[model samples]
Target: MARPQRFDTNQLLDAAVRLAAAAGPAAVTMSAVATEVGAPSGSVYHRFPRRTALLAEVWLRTVESFQQGYLETIEARADAREAGCAAARQVVAWSRAHPREAALLLYGAQDFARAEWSQEHIQRADRGNRRVHAALASLAAALGADGPQATERAVLAMVDLPLSLVRRHLRAGDPLPAHAEDLAEECTAALLGSLPMAPSVSGSRH
Candidate 1:
């Protein structure tokens, strides 16, 4: 049998993540990743034919990992308000657990040369976005809120707001405060509680 591979794909991607997190996406070149992992450049190319592909894979891997936990947390809650709050808290918790990946997430896909991504990569990104939006819509419906305004509120409560908290501390290279999760949950609860509840309709009398 042939000798086992030395540097696996995850090993290369981990190095890439470290580089991107420390110095931004511009630092995640093929040579850089190879040097970071102490692997031959051919090993990276063997796994990812091009830099664009590597960037796409790294971004997708991080995003999908985040989305999986987030979706699970929100879906597991029976109460709409609780679900929203849980999701917000999850963002803070996850960021605290994975600071390097969190730093990589601070930059938008565009910053990773998304425009040069392949159709498959674009589709993967779109699918993740659609799942997130769908989850937000479900949360809005369950909360008795409808229309675009309600969806916007759900997005703000469950995603944007929590991410903003993560972004601020991560950008400053500061560890998230101990109160981060509590703060996120409280803010989300407050926002969701503000939605105007749909009025109950009564049957007309004869």
Candidate 2:
């Protein structure tokens, strides 16, 4: 039987994530990841041909994992308001569970050097973007967000608010408080509640 490959792709990606989170994106070199994982540099190169590939995989993996649960949480709720609140909570919960990956995410995708990524990586990133937009659009429609302003407000309540809450703590290298998820859910509820109610149809009632 052939000897099993000692270093798996996930181990390299995990090392890259830790490097990026601790020392910023520039620290995520192929050699650095190999060193971090105590594997030969050839092992990393075998899995990822270049530094760009490594960075792209790390960023994409983290983002995809995060979006999976977020999309599910929002879609599973029958009520739009509840969906929005759940999405906010999901952000906090995912971050708390994956603080290192979350920290790297605080720097945004551009920091991953997307321009140097292969076309396949770029397309994967675009698909994730579209999925988020579609999910938000569905939530917006369900919430009676007819106008651009209304839709924008809905997006803010569900996306921006919760992201800002996590970004601040992650960027600062501070630990999120135990109540962070609750605070995010409460803030989401408040913002969603404050949105103007959709105008009623103008009709004579019997």
Candidate with top lDDT is 1
Candidate 1 per-residue C-alpha lDDT over 73-189 given as tens digits, one digit per residue, 9 for 90 to 100 = 987877677788999999999999989999999998998889999999999999999998788776777776778887788788889999999999998889999999999999999
lDDT of 1 at 77: 75
Tens digits of per-residue lDDT, candidate 2, 75-157, equal 77767787889999999999999999889888878899998999999999999989999988877777777889989888988
Every model's TM-score: 0.93, 0.93
Candidate lDDT (C-alpha), each: 0.89, 0.87
Those runs of model 2 whose alpha carbons end farther than 4 Å from true positions after fitting are: 196-206
Model 1 has an lDDT value of 0.89
What lDDT score goes with residue 204 in model 2? 9
Model 1 has a clash total of 0
Clashing pairs in 2: none
RMSD (CA, angstroms), candidate 1:
4.7
